[model samples]
Target chain A: MSRGTLALCAAGLLAAILYPLVVRGLAGAGVGVSANYLINVGMLVFFVAFIGQSWNIAGGFAGQTSFGHVVFFGTGAYCSTILHVTHGWNPWLAWPVATAAGALVGWAIGALAFRAGLKGSYFALITLAFAEVFRILANSVEFTRGGLGMLIKADQRPENFQFRDPMWIYYLALALCVVSLAIAWQLTRGRFGARLVAIRENEDAARALGIDVYTEKVKVLALSGAMCAAGGTFYAQKYLYIDPSIAFGVDKSVEMLLVSMVGGAGTVFGPLVGSLVLTAINEGTRSLASVVPALKNVQPLSLIVYGAMLILIVARLPDGLMGLFGRRKSGKRHDA
Target chain B: MLEVRGLSKAFGGLKAVDDATLDVRQGEIVALIGPNGAGKTTLFAAIAGFHTPDAGRVTLEGHDITGLAPHRICAAGMVRTFQITQPFAKIDVRENVMVGAWLRTGERAEAMRRAEAVARQVGMGDQLDQLGADLTVAGRKRLELARALATGPKLLLLDEVMAGLNPTEIAEIVDVIRAIRDSGVTILLIEHVMQAVTSLAEQVYVLNQGRMISHGTPAEIAADPAVVEAYLGHGAAARLARGAAHA
Candidate 1:
């Protein structure tokens, strides 16, 4: 391992150990739900970061740029919900199955599209279509509560993977966030990563160099999907609610892409930074709305802000905010 | 040792490489020479497992690897470089070599160590920290060679490695190729630089209109009428006739 890798591992370990205690300290300081809500927002931020990191395998690293990651998220959410609500199964047991479902979906899509020679904008469009179709199907399905969505038990119980204290959920999400980051880091470091970068930079040349572009791409896609699916299961567990709009929304897909791209798509920490900043901004805007009645109906502001930020990021710092920091250089030519 | 047998590739109706057959012995340096549309690159692509041959087979050390994916082919011990140098632009030269070295070593330190060795071997040790895009054209070509060499390939297929090099750079590349061959690696080079091909290749295959027009020793092929015609066109054939008449 390089010094960089060791330092990252140490930093992650420190964060994992200290985060829960920090949240507890804030609660004791009489911050009330304000601090609790910040922790809540942190949970979402971390979780989004995890999902964004996973998606980067295919989207950023492999240059597949999927807009249908919600397929995995929704599947994982539904599978975990089914296991918990109907069969009374352990959350641990359901988690792997949800991840498997996601991987399989990703594999199927990858094989069909990649084998058929889809890439660039066409691949993006195809993935976007898959997400839309999944959303519509989930909405019309009765077993999924149709448009009504699935609702979990409100009574807090540890045995059921639910707790009275939101802090418990925060710790779980934090732990998961760390694990996801580790996977992302390991995947992008080795020979496998180099091959993906080569494929992304120039597919034909990669092929000429004896790279199995199709298999490499599909594997990354499946891995990314599995990770995102894991995030979905956790998200469902935290909120105790699942709906077509929330679980399979295109907006959520866009959110994942934006978060990763804005932070620095291929870098290990990019998505986490993006999630933190965006979620904080989101929370601040919501609070500002509460303070001023005039801001209540300003629905278009989020889109406008995100759109402007995206344009600025692309035009100025194509690599993202991390590129601005100078701590990391841009990805290699193949990484592009 | 590499053997390509009856290799055929068709893009739509056109057969880019029709019934091409060749063998490269271990530690031998062979050249595939042709004009712009001779399908030398396409044949290289097929032999390296980039393109699925319409028909025929490629055997590396007697393993039938006709339609296997490119990376698998590489793992099986053959590595190829592109015609136009494709460097990992934004990353430093050492990192670009590291990507190739990573194929063999799982650890970063080990790969970087090997990358430095390969960089030195290719005469690029000093430029290890330079980004790929910042390197000159000749520098990019050297980076490509270093990367390919780092993969631990037993057989290397170099496509136009000396395409745009200055005379000094070309000589340096020739030295590197010779060094690689001396290390028990077999080489099959494609080149339009006929002088390099004639000087370095023990055996050469000439391609014309996607067909092998001639295959022989450099001296023998240089004297062949068909070879001269393929290179300089029918006008050259007429010119040769006029020179012979004047003599």
Candidate 2:
């Protein structure tokens, strides 16, 4: 790592650590519910970034683009929720179990799809199908209370994995983001990551070079799934509610993918930056809709803007938003 | 160090490789030479574990490796390069080689050092910083060789590695490959370049219409009627023989 990147990372970390405190200070200065809203927005950025990193791991780094990552997310959310609300297991205990369940789903899907010689679009569609299957199952299942959804008991105690203050949740999201960033960082530096990049570039070539493409694909998917599932659990805890639509929705899948691809897919900070930009756009449009009398209740404006931005990102900024910043030197070729 | 016996693989109704038998003894360079559609590559794939042979067996260092995955076959001490170059376009040449080097060592620095050495060995040291996609055709071919070599394979399979190379480049690669064999790696190459085959390979196997036609020293294969008929049309060998007799 270069000194510049190291210093930049340190600055970013410091800013992230101080974000909540600054918001709290602003609130102390007599800001209204908007201040608390800003805090929530910050939390959303990190939370989305965390799950986005999960998508980035398999889709971006390994070139196994999945359209149904929500399968894992839903699996995580349902697993923990079922355990906590129905089985009477604590959320803290259920978190790890949910994460493992997510990973198992990832492994099963990857193994089946890859072993069947699926790649690119076929692989993607299969993942989407899996998510849909899970969604239908969740809706029809009795333990999940079907379409009624499962709601965790509202107990505002840290011991119960519920907190009275939203700020504590924001801090938790920050920690998850930091950990995810560290994983992405390790990918750029570690042997496993190099193998993934190899597979992404060309799978047959990677296999010819002694990489087990099936094994690596499965491994990365599980890792990504585990991370996403953990995010689902945190999301459930934050809302104290998880329904089929919320847990296994295509919206979360798209959000995760958009944040990663729009920011930068393979890079560590891409999803984080994407989350920030997207959440800002979402909230900014919401506030705009509030102020504008004619456009009141028109939440779809953000979707229109979002659609336009996605097109632009796909067409002009093929490398994602991070390309505007700078390329990682290690990823660049040195000329003879 | 590698032996293949009665290896056969078919794609749909087409028999890509039919009862092909070849071997590479310890520290020897063997060439599999045939005309296009002769199934030389299919045979290579079967031996290297990309295509599971419908029949027969592949053994490396006295251990049966038939039906193993490519990586497992590589771990068992054999690796193959692609006919069309497959380079990791996003990564630099050194990093490309390191993906293969990581097979030998898990340590990044060690893999880096080892990858550099392999690159230099294949005369790609100066281009180590260049991305895989940026390389010229000859460079890509060499990169393929470098990557396979980095795995420290006991037996190396070269699938048409000199297909697009000029004579000068081919000669240079020939020397590099010769040095590799001298350094104790066995080689099984598929080549149409007769100059390279005659110069580098000690044993030559000829394939025609998905079957192994003949195996011998390059000179012997050249003189054989079956080998000549395979390369030319039917009875071209007889005409050549008659022409030679008339001469």
lDDT tens string, model 2, A18-129? 8878878877888765556777899999999999999999999998999999999989999999999998998999999999999999999999999998999999999999
Q: Tens-digit lDDT track for model 2 on B1-247?
A: 7878888999999999998888789989999999999998888888888889999988888899999999999887899999999999978899899999999888887888899999999999899878788999999999999999999998899999999899999999999999999999999999989999999999999999899999999999999999888888889999997998999
Candidate number with greatest lDDT: 2
Scored against the true structure, residue A279 in model 2 reaches a CA lDDT of 94
Per-residue lDDT value at B12 in model 1: 94
Off by over 4 Å in 2: A30-33, A330-336, B241-247
> Can you give the lDDT of residue A79 in candidate 1?
84
Local lDDT at A327 for model 2: 52
Error of 1 at A304 (Å): 2.4
What is the DockQ (computed on Cα atoms) for candidate 1?
0.41
Please give the lDDT score at residue B104 for candidate 2.
Answer: 85
TM-score of chain A of each: 0.91, 0.96
lDDT of 1: 0.83
**Which model scores highest in TM-score?**
2
- After the best TM-score superposition of candidate 1, give how far the Cα of residue A11 lies from its true spot, in angstroms: 6.0
